[model samples]
Target: MKVRVLVSLKPGVLDPQGRAVHHALEGLGFAGVQDVRIGRTIELDLADDTNDEAIDRMCRQLLANLVIEDYSFERLGDGESA
Candidate 1:
């Protein structure tokens, strides 16, 4: 099975990389832009029988920082590419 994990900073947390990108956009004359937030995507191929509990543990223990980050996952069918 294929799984995609989306990890992002929790609300009220600072995101320096996102700020830098936003600044660069304005510098390049991209107007009307508002706030920016950055996140990451992790794609994994695991055994077909992998359980949700195991996947959740993977996120809580290693994939994400529970202190300031939030995560969600999507299971993809065999025919799905992403």
Candidate 2:
């Protein structure tokens, strides 16, 4: 099975890296951009039976920082939904 974990900073948290990218975009002549937030994506290959609960545990324990970040996951593969 294939699983994807997306980790992102929680609202109200300062995102310096995102800000830098936003500035760079403007410098490159991109306009009308309001704000940006940087995040990460993790892909995992697992057994077909791996459940959402287990993935959620992984996200809570390691993939996301509870204080300043939030995480979500999606299962992607043949005939899978979670």
Off by over 4 Å in 2: 79-82
lDDT of 2: 0.91
Residue 68 miss distance in model 1 (angstroms): 1.2
Could you tell me the C-alpha RMSD of candidate 1 in Å?
A: 1.1
- Model 2, 1-82: lDDT tens per residue? 8898999999999999999999999999999999999999998888888889999999999889899999988888676652
Question: What TM-score does structure 1 among the candidates reach?
Answer: 0.91
**Best-fitting candidate, scored by lDDT:** 1
Go through the candidates in order and give each one's C-alpha lDDT. 0.96, 0.91
Candidate 2 has a TM-score of 0.91
Badly placed stretches (over 4 Å) of model 1 are none
